[model samples]
Target: MLILTHTLYLNRPEGEIPIAIRIYRPEPKDGCWACTFEIDWPEGTKTMSGAGLDALQALVISLQMIGIQIYTSTYHHDGALRAYDNEEGYGFPIARNVRDLLVGADKIYL
Candidate 1:
């Protein structure tokens, strides 16, 4: 089951490109929840997964892996979906508190 979907814009030499990110619902297995994140790139589709204690953790670990890949690769940090001119820059507004979800050092599940 799909849990979430996001469209990330990438800036290329020619123009901006849209990339698809899909996250699936976590499933319980072996004392943990397994989650999947799919990235639909122009070349092909790539899927990465991770396991955690709960649904949110699963999503976090899964997304962290994906985020690392995005930041390191050529497809990241170049485009903006909604235009804004601010020194602070654009930020995602989360309705819920995410302080508890933060993991430091080796705590991130690979």
Candidate 2:
């Protein structure tokens, strides 16, 4: 089991909210592995279960719950960038590179 806590900042209400994510795999039954997660936030909490969900998927679900959207695009067929946008029409500048984008993303999603 892995547990992580993060703080998400919102522009709509202009405040910070705490979020907790937990990921674990239950004992295999009939030789299949499944991933389960729980998300805790200021407003409410949610739990999900699935098969073969990776770390990125888990983070995406948590971010979606808090109303943040992530977009990725490739430029000129040479490089890639990511954008972080919220429901209130607020967006972060396009990241210079994937590494830079992941660094910013880790703060909110990890």
lDDT of 2 by residue, 1-101 (tens): 65443333322345433445555544343444445556563456666654434544444444433222222322212222222342221122233344234
Give the 10-residue window scoring lowest on summed lDDT in candidate 2.
73-82
Over 4 Å off, model 1: 77-110
Tens-place lDDT digits, model 1, residues 7-27: 666556687777787889988
Clashing pairs in 2: none
- In order, candidate lDDTs are 0.60, 0.39
- How badly does each model clash, as a count of residue pairs? 0, 0
Q: Evaluated with lDDT, which candidate comes out highest?
A: 1
- Residue 64 lDDT (model 2): 39
Model 2 misses residue 41 by how many Å?
Answer: 3.5
Give the top-scoring candidate (TM-score): 1
All-Cα superposition RMSD per candidate: 8.0, 10.5
Which residue pairs clash in candidate 1? Answer: none
